[model samples]
Every structure is written in structure tokens, then in C-alpha cells.
Target: MSATRVQVVPNGPVLVSGPVRIEMPDGDVVESDRFMVAICTCRRSDDYPLCDTSHRRCRNVSAAPERLGDRIEREAR
Candidate 1:
């Protein structure tokens, strides 16, 4: 089994890659198209569900996660 990793950039979207499953708060789990997916850090994005390079407007990497939904943390080895 491949280990999963999720990281929070200083000013970017959640850098999540590797073999992992993304589960929504509504008990919905899905897989990414690629091994890595850059979520929108900037909210001013037209194409959500995928990054539309809107981070440039905010001058950040990507958008942030839900206000109080899915959480990303590193697992201790």
C-alpha cells in the first residue's frame, strides 16, 4: 500500500499527493485524477473542483480547505 501525504503550503493550496483517498465531510470519498492535485488557494476561481490558476490574483499558491470540514495533517512514522 502506498503511503499518503497532505501538506499545507505557506500561501498555497493543500499539496496532496501519493496514494490517498479524499473524503468529503458528507462521507463521500473520491480519488484524484493524478497523483498530485493543487486545490485552489484563492477563492476567486471560476473552475472549482479544479484549479483555474486563480491563485495569481491573490498572489498565493492555492485556495484553502473548508472552513470546518476536511482537515489535513501529517502522520507520524
Candidate 2:
């Protein structure tokens, strides 16, 4: 049996190194031969049990610039 290693990224996924087999709640078994895998911690992933980089913080396009401008205006006043 090969040794398995797990790593926890700050504010990110749990990375697993070495061959792994994941058993899902629905009685599904997922197997991988890759050297590393990222398991999602946040439930927002479209690919459950896998890290698709969805855990990264997204910029709020509709509000971020407006909020910055408002803060600058308030500071100027």
C-alpha cells in the first residue's frame, strides 16, 4: 500500500498526494491515479468532492467600484 499524504491550504482545499479512492455518499466510488488531488472544503463547488478553484473569493462587480467611489467621496467631504 502506498503512503497517502494530505495537505490543508489556507482558505482553500485539502490536497491529497498519492493514489486515492473516494467513496461518495451515494455509493459511488471515485478513483484517481494522479499524484495529487484537491478536495473542496466549500460546498460551492460545481464538481463536488473536487476543487475546481471555486473557493477563491470573487470580486463583486456590481458593488465594489461603487463602494470604493463612495468611500473616496466621503473621505473628500
Which candidate gets the maximum lDDT versus the true structure? 2
Model 2 lowest lDDT segment of ten: 58-67
Alpha-carbon lDDT, every model? 0.56, 0.71
Q: Which lDDT tens digits does candidate 2 get at residues 1-77?
A: 77877766655667899877889999998787889998776655788787788767643223433454456568769
TM-score of 2: 0.65
Give RMSD to native, each candidate: 5.4, 13.1
Full-model lDDT, candidate 2? 0.71
Which residue pairs of candidate 1 clash?
Answer: 12-62, 13-62, 40-62, 40-63, 41-62, 41-63, 42-62, 42-63
What lDDT does candidate 1 reach at residue 3? 67
Whole-model lDDT, candidate 1?
A: 0.56
Residue-level lDDT tens digits of model 1 in 10-51: 554556676445665688775666888766556565754445
Give stretches of model 2 more than 4 Å off: 58-77
